[model samples]
Target: MFKQIVFLKRNRIRKKSKLVKQVLLLSFDFTSLFYTLLVIGYFVIAIVMEGNIRNNIQDKIISIEAYTVEQFWVILTAIPIIYIIRSFNQPGVIFSTAEYTLTFLPNTLQQVWRVVAIERWIKSGITYLIGGIIIYILSPTSASIVLLYIFILIGLNVLMTLPEWKLFQQHLWLKIVVLISLILINLVNLYLKSSFLSILFIAILFLINVLLLPRTFQQIDWKKVTAASDFKIWNMVMISYVTKIKYRKERQYSIWQRLSFWKKPFLYKKSVGYNRLWHLYFEKNIGVCLKLIGALFLLLFLILFIKEELFFLAIAFTIHSSSTVAASLFNDRLRTDLVQMLPWDLTLFKQTILKWIYSTSALLLLPIIMFIFRDLSVWTLIHVLAMIFSFLFLMPIKIEKVFKKFDNKASDFKWTEIFCYILILLIIISNIYLEFLIGVCLMMGIIPILKKAEK
Candidate 1:
């Protein structure tokens, strides 16, 4: 059975289609030896640093540090529960018939317990090792205690994963009820300042999940599982999935048109039809716009309610939006082969791109305005205007310059990508300085240069 499992995993990797192979190859190449070196170097540095800290730090300071370490471990444990639940909804990267066969196995409870046990052992062992090292480094006096706590915590985390797994197998309403109950439990624990109890509760839930797993497995069909096709059904159930498919189709169509030399020039002319630029833009990109809007709203909602630390969450959202906008511009640049073929004058093409950038910038600004401002004020207005102007004017020029420089390369990253990096840094710093005017002026300067580049 073990050999069969191993063979299945190996076949999944080996028999991947050309596109999948390409994606895996690209990811591997991009990461390369740096990943191995990075892991080794991090462990070495951590060990050395820990030794130095243990030798030098005072006892009182070490005690304080240990509390921080414990808190960090608790947060890390909680975060991955959400991630594991999220991963189940994602399609499996590795194909496996064994997963199907598991449903048919006799002694389902024993088999399920074995799977859960092995998973917990591996997970808990790693967590214990890391926590042990941390405790030894920071508070060697509590090393053994920390190791025991870590074991408990790891067991708890594994237990928590089980209930969440079972909850995910339910109807949408039932799943929502489970989620709400869990959230209420967490909230009450937080209100009472009960971290250890929270961990314990999570652990209890995992035990329940284990109890339920065999039944869940029994309910699943083994023989017909491999033949199942439900992407369409899933799409119908998940609005987000539907939106994603629409976005993907539109993106693919745009990419195809942009890659076709014969069709490019004529299609470029069609882009400006009826002088109805807004309609054209929406027709081509509303799916992407809606996606961004959804993301922004979701992020703002999380920042307001979900995360305890609002400041970092706010900054993260801003940075995420800015980076996404910059990346989209880069993608647009990659489609420049079609742009070059456009019958429209080069200057006109530049103008149209500038207009598109402005429109997108406006759309992006709506989220920031809604999230960051409590009421309408001159300062808020100024900040909003400055941000919009900067993104509209400066972002396009920077994108154009970067794209021109890296036009020959098909890779995701190039030296020219640094322009967007610098732009993000500037935006962050400008926000810090509260110098809205500086940003506005900087953006204004880019227009003339962009025009000159068009020529």
Candidate 2:
């Protein structure tokens, strides 16, 4: 049985390794792959032994920092703290549903635990082993730091079975007390600035969890255990043979949502057609509108306050909003059958949206941006703004025109292939120049592709 378990585990590891190998070989050219590997290897080596990690790296990798030993302790401490919290919610071991089933039927928790421990070690053993060796080298006098790393890894694994004991689950006060006690240990260590004391407390915490695992195995919540491994669907299908599992409760709508004007129609005339239709969908799911608005507001905030991130945010929002608008229009087009039949020219819609975006919103937005940032260029913002609106205006028309070609021929997903060309063209054009010249260049690039695809 143990050999069988090991064989199954080995196969999973092999499949993952094979997929990664294929992706690396196929996706990138040799020169690009070679350079990327060199850069990654340099950083990995730098991180592993930079001045023996007593001090943080001082480098040009802006915003990201490599923490010193003292700071890393806090970050490392978060692991045990996080697992303790997780143990409350999930006491399920990291076995798959099939593995869980097999282990439950034939093996004692201790016996199965040893197998799992071996698997866990196989997965992360070398990584922590290297870490332990480094800690030992750094503070050879403090031998307990090596044990600290070991116990931390073990405790993380053990705490997943936390709720198998009432000391954590049924007793809410006890759990809180345990959490507070652990936190206080950190506090005392911080107050004293004692590395030895912190290491001692952390190791002791993990040791306790390691001891608790087998004792509490009989009290394991099978429902939560199965749920953790996502076995509920299987349980539902085989309801007679397997026990009924309680899944997560359905989402409850807030009182404000129930009472609010979600279902109320937009105050627009019937002639609005697609405009009214889109608004109706947005109204029903107003979160979409609110979220888009929130993102726009966040962009404004980032520009004003976090100026360093403004360019990155602009690029992100441009790409994100472009995809979102394209997706929304595509989904909404499918929803409105009448709108699809109507002669809906994107040129008019583009002009209308651009009018509001370029004139009204820009007038209000650019002034505030200009006031706060005198040195910063508004060119990037204007460029991204134009690109986002271009995608919104172009891609649907591109898709529509592609589909029209298939009206005569046998309908196939050749339009999807055609749209890829249009998308790539727009992206390329937008990156170089930000103007209406995009339309002319776009038509020049697209007409030939359309003709070839139509053939």
Best by lDDT: 2
- Which model scores highest in TM-score? 1
Scored against the true structure, residue 84 in model 1 reaches a CA lDDT of 42
TM-score, candidate number 1 = 0.40
CA lDDT of each prediction against the hidden true structure: 0.49, 0.50
Which segments of candidate 1 are over 4 A away from where they belong?
A: 1-54, 57-64, 69-118, 121-138, 143-148, 163-385, 392-455
- Estimate TM-scores for all models: 0.40, 0.36
Would you give me the overall lDDT of model 1? 0.49
Q: Flag clash pairs in model 2.
A: none
Looking at model 1, the pairs that clash are 159-206
The number of clashing residue pairs in each candidate reads 1, 0
